[model samples]
Target: MDFEKLLVWQRAKALTVSVYKEMAACPDLVFKSQITRSALSIPSNIAEGMERFTARDKCRFLRIAKASCGELRTQLMIGSEIAYVAEPLAAVWIIETRELSKMLNGLINRISD
Candidate 1:
């Protein structure tokens, strides 16, 4: 199964792009760097996991991606509170992170079984 064929991977890739674009002009270098890294980790991990030879390896990377979703969500929240991110955009990204997390969970369970 190619990671590109997965809807979750597609969504995560899109979200990462959005995050990069949104943070491109951010004045807070530290926050922007951290948030963007978290965003990038999601799809990256998914792709890596899907390419793994074993189910255990796949699950490990998927779990990392899921955790990255949570990390991204937290960063988004902080970005919104600190005015680094617009409230509406942050809300949307946060929702995406939650959905991505759930999707990763489902994928993990399916792979585990």
Candidate 2:
């Protein structure tokens, strides 16, 4: 299966772009870099896994992507708590990222089984 064509990959790519745009607006370099990297990891891992030769390898990467999604969600929560991010904006990102994580987990489970 082509990772480029996967819905998980598409959502993750969009999330990464959104993270970059959001981070660009922030004044703090530390949080910006961290969040952006976490966001990028979601899709990057999926793409890297897709290039692997086995379904097991793909599942491993998908799990990593899901973990990154969780990490991104936590960062968003922290950003909102500290006022680095607006509540509504963080809410939107959290919802999307959480949903994507769930989707990735499902895919991984199905493939592994």
Clashing pairs in 1: none
Clashes of 1: 0
Q: List the residue pairs that clash in candidate 2.
A: none
Candidate 1, residue 90: the lDDT equals 96
lDDT of 2 at 33: 93
Give the distance in Å from residue 108's predicted Cα in candidate 2 to where it truly belongs: 0.2
lDDT of 2 by residue, 1-113 (tens): 88899998999999899889878988999999999999999999999988889888988898899999999999999999999988999999999998998899888888888
Q: How accurate locally, in lDDT, is each candidate? A: 0.97, 0.92
Candidate 2 off by > 4 Å: none
State in Å the error of residue 75, model 1. Answer: 0.3
Model 2, residue 38: C-alpha shift (Å): 0.1
How high is each candidate's TM-score? 0.99, 0.96
Per-residue C-alpha lDDT of model 1 across residues 19-40, encoded as one tens digit per residue: 9998999988998899999999
Candidate 1 residue 33 Cα shift, in angstroms, is: 0.7
